[model samples]
Target: MAAAAAAPVWSVDPRTGKRREQVAVEATAAEVDTAVRAAHAARPALADRAVRAALLRRAADLLDAAGERVIEAADAETALGPGRLTGELARTTYQLRSFADSVDEGAFLDVRIDHADPALAPPRPDLRRYKIPLGTVAVYAASNFPLAFSVPGGDTASALAAGCPVVIKAHPDHPATSELCAALLRRAAADVGLPDGVIGLVHGFQAGLDLVRHPQVRAAGFTGSVRGGRALHDAAAARPHPIPFHGELGSLNPVVVTESAAAERAEAIGAGLAGAMTLGTGQFCVKPGLVLAPEGEAGDRLLTALTAAVSDTEAGVLLDHRMRDAFLDGVRTRAALPGVQAPVTPGAGGEHTVSAGFLTLAAAALAEDGTHDLLLEECFGPVTVLARYTDEAEVAAVLARLPGNLTATLQLGADESAGRDGAGRGARLLADATALAGRVVVNGWPTGVAVAPAQHHGGPYPATTSTATSVGTTAAERWLRPVAYQDTPPALLPPELREDNPLGLPRRVDGRAEHA
Candidate 1:
């Protein structure tokens, strides 16, 4: 018999440039099968709304209890500061609790009903509709946001909230944190008297591929680079029973400042832009990669202030050397392009650090056919591009060429009013911004994403695999599918869809919504 191959998981500390901990061995194909089957088996337990809510709350409590240890491990592996990691842990726990509330409310099911009507020319039969879980979800972890976007992150929380089991493929960068989180979640499931495999953790590249290919995995969620997300998306599609793949690939989230707005808030906007671009070393997927500003005194003042702010900014280390190398390479590529000038040239600050910076280019350059088109893509670090526009027409044209983003911001002047009349200059700009991004900000930056009910963290195409979100309360919607019960008996129908409304769920009856 042939011997099995070994996959060792190691934690590399970015700050020290050394491997600090050996987390675990990667899961083999047989182990992957075991995890998936266990998750599939646990789907029955998840059917109980009370059980689901309890499990989520237990997980949140356990995470809260392990607060200090979790934060320290995450910071040790990711090199994200203790303060930042602590804040991320808070957000992570808050998201878990939020999902618990969502599961308890049961509104994510979206139940509806219509009685039989035989009097009309073509009367419809009795019909009812409500969403159900799609089964096990394979969640791919992100390198950044170790706690919030990894192991016990939004994807995992949303899946569990939707009554779907999650098998998380831990990001290679933070294996220790992943293991710790998985243990806490498993303990929570046990405390709630749920199945052990409600949350599974696997390490290594092969396990991730196995997860997507497994027939038991009915859906998947990912937050990562375009290259990786695209590959996984294709693999999931090629499966016999293709599942929903909600992959949040990166974005070049663009911003536009009206000439007058820049004039009025030059210093404030400049400092704010500097802060946004460098937030988390610009690791956020929604970091503004491009900005459209007019060419005049206003533009110059903004650029000068922005340059000063960026220069004043201290050097910072990235997640890892691999990310640092990529950031440097991307900056070099952009700087070499025609009409691209490095106003704040971003590159390696030292053997271990990356400096914040920006690039300048004429807005017309973006309208050109070939080279400038690359500027529309994300650079993935503390770097941004300033697209200088000569006129309003040029600004509009530049915005049109950009791809969809998770967010698009338009800093408007005092005179600029967004009204339906279409007579105002910025009013017309609203439509353009709306067409480009999922979340439109009029006078703010895109770095700080809130965890709220109305939040939308996904956008068109490359921004995400679908229009569904991977954050906030509505994120669970991605892991669900609607089923219609036509001419079905009352007892045979789901409690939420039955005439009695035993579950006390909100539903629409006879084309009218009923609160009870």
Candidate 2:
């Protein structure tokens, strides 16, 4: 019997809906297994913190050296423009260096020690605890930001920082970019005296499934749609030895415009909303999809400003044809709903691009669950739904019905901002936002996500499969597990756990923080 040939993976241009080139063949199950095993084999090479840190820095340097070529390749497949791709590449390299710094600092290990107390009524033995890497990780690349969220993204960087080898499942939208970045990462590993298998790449739908179920793959990180992330999360759970699945699924990043806020800066708020919702063609996961604006003259003024801004903006190409079709269908369906009005209709611009716009409906309609509930769901394009509310009760009702989000924003007025209203209306709204999202914004939009230690890029339920973030310095925590050694001999202790601090790692000794 002859083995079936693997299907070819092509790099397609979303701008013209044409195949740019054949990047590689879809990996078969055997090939996926090979990649995972290879990654697993390279685990020991990343055990040294210095080596891991060096590898990350080298990877960032290599990516920077190839910035022009990398950006060109990503732009060709994603249609995201050279400027956006350049920024994405810069963010990607910055994330790599940040994780490298995290590796060198070694705070992520979380070392703790409790000395033996022989005089106590119930004697206690010496116990030392610290985190260790969870072997190889399977990273599912995203389709939007081909550089920052795809090949050399935060997930891969964080996993490597945690001392885990990575096998990235390339997004179908940008296979060439993935291949190029993977090669650079492998070269960096080799330059640091680590095995090339420290970084792995595979392309295929089934290959993604195979990678998650592989016994050697201890954990996985994902960034994609709700349906796809949920399916993979289920697959990881169904495994006999289930692994941790950190998936950034979806969010209807909601924004609320207080009456006073609209009165104070209706034009500014509307213009900002237009820019935020249409940025990157509204492909950002944190794009404000739903907004609650007060009804009356001020809200009307805001709407007028929004309409002008969106109308003046040009139509843009999406990442792929499927997303374009989905966006158009979503707009059409939402527009057809009763009581919904498209202040400026959003739909296909040319055969390849889509225009940006917004839809309006009464907040009362969304207060109770029904057909209008569809309005609360995320539409991944340059469109946002504006729901007009008559009072605070209507605002609460509409907000209560929203699903979990990565970010929730509140536009407050001067009095609210200063907490001088005496009624604490702003406090209540801020509290409500905190309950519904991981990151809450005040008088700002949720379009751009910063890569910093304090950033929280995940939220409840459908927003993410786990509480762990897919961005920032703490993201590496997802790939580690704590281990405790009880009454172990000094000679047997790891350098980080020794009585005499050797590695100069930050640790907690006898319930007190000790800096080496």
Candidate 3:
């Protein structure tokens, strides 16, 4: 009998349990361009609305079909419980379908046309405008969201739908899962008669930098720590021809609980905060990292509930060893600071596990000196800091000092603004805090990121470089730029913007809105 082939040995990292393997790495600048060129060459045909939508739907189908298997692989690699991983898979698929729906709606094309009016002074000419695809996109798959933000995630899906080819710099934290997902996406592209290069995945730190620096890579999407994202952002900016780098970096999502709300339901708020902080081991960028509460009984009651809730909670593994180390070190630093009290110390529960807990300090201490201000930094794990204020004005002061964030939540009592007097105060406070964040939430947790039309997922600097966008149907706008064609014959216009517009899409004609 012929000798049996040797099976590839994949060792799993205990921190995230991500299976490790030695895959062929893309080595040269020329190889990087080849990948980008392949995508660019395939762009024209894939730009068709029907073609893009079908491919997106097919990708969704593949993910749906392999949902359980993908979840199993992710769990085996990351140790994220099946329940959460399964939900992540569902969210990831929903995101794909969401982009497909956006394409089907066709509003993303944003067509505008102005016909010639020679009678006007200076002999006005016909002008028509439509969004054109950016050439090729480089996507940096995120570790926290291996499924949703990796290979087949928003960046890849949105870029592909925009007719911009994508080259993914796979997040090393979950390379194995990234490989599987990328293969499935490539197969989907082939099924739709599109080039396999429509999606590409490369491993290694060097390979990622090469992909980002490749002359043909027109733009990139990143989700990671502030340090990592900033480095890539600078590289993209410093290139000979700078490109757009849409990145969602660090955030300390703060939640404000009014005195009235705390008085009515301290325990409920504590329990809810615990769930949000510890969800997926505090891996979400939107995790509530800070809490601002009023003083006296309400604050005491909140502390009591928070302490009890955190103490009872068990430790959970982070996405990787680096994160685990940061979490432990953060707890140690905060717990050691003067005037800082951890009613519930979120210490290391196991070798690779840490508990969800909180640290409390007087607002005066934070205001007095920046020494204890380390509390303001994000711990990047299942931990939160509660800052107690003596008055509403103090709370407002602290809110003013807060850095840009992805989300800022307000926990209001039912009658928080029922009367004119209360409404004025609440409105002013909410407005001030809202100005400091990208998305403002009222009476709900910021952890649940809903995929909806009005969602603004991006935030101020550090939260995201571009304040105007986040990962949504709106994200497609980033991969496209409007080109105005002047004095063009109807025959020369793109089919979608022609006078007889066969697609029946909404468009601006002769300075007025029209359909079909």
Candidate 4:
């Protein structure tokens, strides 16, 4: 018997709904195994912090050097526009360099030590603890962020920073861009005296399944739809030795507008909402999908402004035809629901593009959860759902029905902002927002996510699978596991845990902080 021919992977242009080119063939099961094993074999090279840091910096330089070519390819396949793709590339390179700096800092190791205490009840023995790389990580690239969340993205950079080599399951939407970025990363590894196996890329849906199931792949990171992410999560858990599956799934990212806030600047709020919801064709994971607004003259003014802004906005192409169809279907379903009125109809535009729009409904309908529950789900295009509420209790009722989200935003009035007459109400709302989301916004939109140390990009179920973040310095922590050494011979101990503290890493000794 002979092997079957490998399937071809084509790069399609979203704008024209045509295949741009055939980038590569789908990786077979054997190929996926080879990629995983190769990455696993190269893990030792990343164990050295200095070499790992150099590799990251070199990768960033190479990416920046090829910025024009990279952006061109990304824009062609994704139809995201040159301007947006350029910024995404910049963010990707910045992330690589930032992870290199984090590697040098070495705080992610999280070393801790405690000397023997003879006076203690149980006579505690000497112990030293620190984190070690889990092993080779499998990264599932995302469709929306071809660069920042795809190849050479945060997951890959952070895994390498934690001394784990990576094998990326390239996103079907951007295979060519993935191949280009993977080549640069491999070149970087070789330049820094590491093996080309330090980075690996594979294409196809089945390849993703094979990569996750490979024994050598110790952990996995993913970004995609709830259905897709949940399926992968289940696969990882079903493995004989279940691996940690950290997935950024779906999010509704609801927004709440107090009556006073709407009264203060309904027009401004409406215009801002229009911009945020339609940004990136409302493809952002943090895009505000549902908003709770009050029912009154002020709210009507807000709706009027939003209607004008969205009507004036032009239609745009999504990442793919499937997403365009899904967006249209979602809009149609929600629009046809009882009491749901389309202020501006959102559906297919010019056969290839989709126009932006919003749906209006009574908050009371969403309070107890009936057929209107569909509105709470995320619709991945330029559309939003506005629920008109009669009172704060109605607002609370609607909010309580919402699922876990990446962010929860509150539009506050002047009195609320200053903690004046409505201080108690503001405090209560803030607390509620905090309880519902990982990141809470006050008087602002949830469209942009900053790559900062203090940023928390993960939240409760559906938003992410684990408590860990997929961004920031702490993201590296996901690929590491802590190990404690107990009363080992002095000479046999690793330098980081040795009594002499040869590495000079920041650690806690005898319950006291020791700075390098």
For residues 89-207, could you state the per-residue lDDT of candidate 4 as single tens digits? 88888888889998888888889999889899999999989999999999999999999999989999999999999999999999999999999999999898999888999999999
TM-score of 2: 0.99
lDDT of each: 0.90, 0.94, 0.81, 0.92
Worst 10 residues of 1 by lDDT: 414-423
Better of 1 and 3 by lDDT: 1
Return the top candidate by lDDT: 2
Q: lDDT, candidate 1, residue 504?
A: 84
Clash totals, every prediction = 0, 0, 1, 0
Q: Is candidate 3 or candidate 4 better by lDDT?
A: 4
Q: Tens digits of per-residue lDDT for model 1 on 8-83? A: 8999989878999788999999999999999999999888999988988889899999999999899888778989
Report the lDDT tens digits of candidate 2 across residue range 56-125: 8999999999999998999999989999888888899999999999888889999999999998879989
* Model 1 spans > 4 angstroms off: 418-423
Candidate 2 at residue 38, lDDT? 91
In candidate 2, which residue pairs clash? none
